[model samples]
Target: MPGRLKLYHNPQSRAVTAHWMLEEAGADYDLVPVEFREDGTRDPKILAVNPMGKVPTLVLEDGTVVTEVPAILAWVADAYPEKNLAPAPGSPERGSYYRWLFFVGSCFEPALIERMMRQDAEPLPKMMVGWSSYDDVIDTVEGALKGREFLVGDHCTAADVYMGAGLWWGGMFKGPRILESEIIQGYIARLAERPAFQRAMGG
Candidate 1:
């Protein structure tokens, strides 16, 4: 039997990604909605559960708390391997799966933030930059996604869970067709069609 799963969520936050992941993993869980207070503060009650006061925090039956979007998705998938949302550790595809997941959090996110803040004009050492540049990161991801349905292969894995969410958010800042590349747009479209994603999106 699986453990009880509790998901703290605020639809407008990163919790949306975990909601899709929970549906994809087919995990038995409950979504506790959090609302911002009228006084311009987050719900103090949730702050007790997550000191960082962030949404999308996962609480396991064993009372363990998991934060961070990628970590939460990775844990939920690993906890329910029967879903096969990820390549098991030690497999060749696992390397690519992990690579894509981390790259979104480490590389793509920073670049998007930098671009949105309009700070890219400042001279900075490319080597010192983590995500390098938005253009470079987009090119790298587009090249990798060209012939593959998913980041790892033809199968939908946990990496797609994160990457797809990233693309959706990127579209908000970069416009509706940020990933209009033939392959990437199609790939994201396919992922969007999944019953799980649609279901999580309140289909």
Candidate 2:
């Protein structure tokens, strides 16, 4: 049966990741675009769903409200295994898969945001910030993606969906400096070649 997926989205945001995930899973979903005014105010109804009023919230057919980007993608991937978007826990690949998934939210994201801010907050203790330094985090990313076409390996898993999307966005920004690696360049170019990515970009 087709899963009922309600994607609260706007093309201009990270909802594009959710959009690509939906397309990859071949899920039956309704893409609902929520609009805000030029002054940056949102509908009271949307604020009810997400107090932060962020885009890309996924509401399951059963009415479970999922928040955050990585959480939503991981949930959607696990919910539909036949789609093969994730690696099973018992599989050796699962560990590495989870690493990238969590890294996207835990490390890469915060680091990217900090770089974009061009300001630093009080440093998190080494143990507190999962990603210690921007270069360290990026070097880890380079290591993970260096020799492989995908994060874990040859197959594109949910990890890549998030990682690749994050790469695409970071590539747009001046920080992270990913293009220098031939591997990263090839991998990101591969992601861009995906029909889903193309369609998302109006290809």
Candidate 3:
């Protein structure tokens, strides 16, 4: 059986994504609010759980630590199969599920960060960079949600929570401005209307 779950979080940070996921999973978890140093460094207590010192670190019931937004979302979904937030193992949709999850983490996230920070690196070959370009990443995500209500299946799942949170934050921060399309806006609206998402936002 799974042990007690605890999340080290900072509401203003990416931990909001995990907070949403935990709600979607319907898993009981203790929230450990972390304070940031005046210099913008993370609290050492958070660093103890995640050397990377990132918010959204999840400590499993058995004392296993899970970091990174993608990993935490995936773990929560899988751990609570009764919630059906993720596709079952060995199912065909599982491929689409994992693909979008990793795409959000590996591709879209880096691209958004680079644009937000206004990186000055010389243009590298599209093959060299994982994201290729921010526009390319945004276009791909837009295309995925063009006519669909959810990324993977008919109903909302972990993919929606993960990707939706990214899009919502991207628009909220106005950094990369990736959520400019009507399709994406509509999708985000749907996500925002969810009870789980509302609860995560403390509404």
- Per-residue C-alpha lDDT of model 3 across residues 1-203, encoded as one tens digit per residue: 45579999888888988999988878888999999778977788898888888888999877889998988988888888888898988899999999998998888888888877766875446788999988898889989998899999898888888889988888877845455688889999999998889988763
**Candidate 2, residues 25-139: lDDT per residue as tens digits?**
7778898788867888886656877888888889888877887888888887887789788888778888889889889988988887776775456555557676787777788
> Which residue ranges in model 1 land beyond 4 Å of their true spot?
37-40, 119-124, 175-179
- Report the C-alpha displacement of residue 86, candidate 1, in angstroms: 1.2
The top-ranked prediction according to lDDT is 3
The full ranking of all candidates by TM-score, starting with the best, is 3, 1, 2
Expressed as tens digits, the lDDT of each residue in 146-187 for candidate 1 is: 877888867888899899888877876663237566666787
Q: Go through the candidates in order and give the C-alpha RMSD of each one to the true structure.
A: 2.0, 2.3, 1.8
lDDT, candidate 2, residue 151? 85
Model 3 TM-score, all chains together = 0.93
Query: For candidate 3, what's the RMSD?
Result: 1.8
| Model 1 lDDT on a 0 to 1 scale | 0.84
Instruction: List ranges where model 3 is wrong by over 4 Å.
Output: 119-124, 176-179
lDDT of model 3 at position 124: 48
TM-score for each candidate, following the candidate numbering? 0.92, 0.89, 0.93
